[model samples]
Target chain A: MKLWVSPRAPSPRRVLMFIAEKGIGDVELASVEIGRGEHRSAAYLARSPLGKVPVLELPDGRALGETRAICSYLEGRHPEPNLMGIGFEEHAFIEAADRRVEFYLLGTIANWIRHGHPGLAPLEQPQFPDFSAAQGRKLREVAGWLDGELQRQDWVAGKRFTIADITAFCALEFARGLMKFRPADEGFEALQAWRDRIAARPSAKAGA
Target chain B: MKLWVSPRAPSPRRVLMFIAEKGIGDVELASVEIGRGEHRSAAYLARSPLGKVPVLELPDGRALGETRAICSYLEGRHPEPNLMGIGFEEHAFIEAADRRVEFYLLGTIANWIRHGHPGLAPLEQPQFPDFSAAQGRKLREVAGWLDGELQRQDWVAGKRFTIADITAFCALEFARGLMKFRPADEGFEALQAWRDRIAARPSAKAGA
Candidate 1:
């Protein structure tokens, strides 16, 4: 499989980090230059209709897009050190946690950065600062909520450092890079501590 | 298990339709009135921190939030009518399809409605018409893309009517109800036909 990636983007980085965590060795990496509009090219769009990055092209030439979907494929292929969960019940809870962080935190950060940052003006046309400001507030609210969760548990999902942590960490790191956001600055001590801990992992350094 | 739902909302309706599709009868229903702010009540918030509807409370009293996660749990329990998929590759592709429609279509429609509709002012503070307009444009783009897909295939994902169809159908239905969107009116014949097919299903009437 060839994984088409744009390392700079948070979504692609999530899949790359997941691969690093699993120590998957079979897949090959092919970079797509977003600045050059490579992802929008006909060839690339054939693989990913939406022109998104981190598309896993299978051996038969079929491609699987979406970060979570790609990660799910990897988890199914390489089951060791499982980041999702074991049983049906565990899977539901873990997925619920992952979706929570993905939708509320990462998604909010994406909206804020896309609308607030001038650098993203080309990608997100006619940026709206007021809308971005609303998302920014929502992001901080979710970050604080996450901090409360971390205060009670060791991982974002629950007892284990599951895929939920990878999602939340990637979201936080994206904000750190583009929005210059830090949970510590906002008095979210537990969330900041959790971020520090995750940053120390080898997988966190993947494609950085 | 008890499924907490607010049928008036799209997210909860997704789960409701899933239940009808699976023919699962063991799960009980408990309604939460969103208009009455019951979803924001302390008890509901404890079940779902995000306070979203359609939370599946397990027999042990543990709650599983997130529509997809709840559906996954139900799928695992009742695998006969397999809405997800059987194996890893299929799971990845199906999920990829599901996510595409979800993030691009449903999510965009949500942004447009929440920010543009005056009735949603209480839920989405400080509405941004410009941002909502952008999302409306994005929604049309995605809808056209989906119409193209349906032109080539029988279902949203592929040959089968998987969970992807469920998501796409729900998204289109929501747009139809809220935004007065009609794919046929825009010359998206394939998409309109597919929507009609799904609308004819008994599951489509599970909530509405």
Candidate 2:
């Protein structure tokens, strides 16, 4: 199997970290330069119509796109180090938390980065005219919510290290380059500690 | 298991359709009124800190929020009529298509409706001052993309009926309230037929 990825993209990093954590070694990486618009090339488009990075091409030539979907596939294919959870209730809890991180946290962060960062404005297009103010407000709101949630749990999905933590950690770390973390924010102690723990993971460092 | 849902909300309707499709019984429905802002109530907040509707409260009192996650849980527990897919590859295909519909198509439609429709402005902060133009552009872009995709395949994720179809169909139908379908749009013949077929399903009608 070959994984088409971009070095700097958050979505691709999510998959790479999963690969590392799962200790999957039969995969090859084909890097695409997003800055050069390599993802939009005809070759890449055949693999992913959306022109997004992190497209996984199977041995049979079938290609799968989307980070979470790829991660889900990996978890299913390699069930020993279960990232999705084992039973019905656990599955529900992990998925619920994962969706929350994606829809609420990561979605907000993406909107912020797309609308706020000067470099990304052209990519996001006409919906976001003045990206700075809109992006800033969204970032602050998302961070506040995430900090609160982290304070109440040992991990993003509760006591276990699940895909929710992966999603949140990737987004939070990505946001650091664009938005400053408020160290003095209330209920962020646990979040800070959690961040350090996640960062120390061998998969995260290797993936980065 | 009890499903906490709200009438007139498309997210909850997705869950309703999943339940009906799977022939899963013994699941009770608990209504939460979004119009009255009951989703933000203290009790509901405890169930879902995000305070969103369509939360599935397990028999053990633990609640699962997010429509996709709840549907996923249902699909996992009752795997006979699988809404996700069969095996690893099929699962990835369905999930990839599902996420595409959610992030690109559904995201655009919901943004258009929430920001464009005067009725939904209060639900989320009305950031986009010019509602109509933004929403109109978003609708056109999303519908055109969907029409193109539907023209090529029997179902969203290939030959089989999956959650991708459910998500896309729900989003398209929900958008009908705001945007009219252009029958004249090129390559939409298959989409029109597919829409009708999905509408004929007992689950769709029941959910509606």
| Candidate number of the best lDDT | 1
lDDT of 1 by residue, B1-208 (tens): 9999886678888998999999999989999988778989999999988888889989999899999999899999999798998898898889999999999999999999999988777778889988899899988899999999999999999999988898888888878887899999999999999999999999999777
Alpha-carbon runs more than 4 Å astray in model 2: A127-135, A182-187, B129-139, B181-187
Computed on alpha carbons, the lDDT of every model, listed in order, comes to 0.91, 0.78
- In the order shown, the chain A TM-scores of the predictions are 0.98, 0.90
Residue runs of model 1 more than 4 Å from their true location after superposition: none
Error of 2 at B156 (Å): 0.9
Model 2: lDDT equals 0.78
Clashing residue pairs, backbone N/CA/C < 3 A, model 1:
none
Q: What is the lDDT of residue A36 in candidate 1?
A: 80
lDDT tens digits, residue span A1-208, model 2:
8999887677898898888888999889999987778987998989998787799998898899999889888887788688888876687788888888887767777777766677775456654644335655666666667778778878888887888888888887777766664434544666778888888999886446
Per-residue error for B41 in candidate 2, Å, reads: 1.2
lDDT per residue for candidate 2 within B100-164, as digits (tens), equals 98888778778777766777766757447463356567566656666678788788888888888
Instruction: Output the number of the DockQ-best candidate.
Output: 1
Q: What class would a CAPRI assessor give candidate 1's docking? A: high
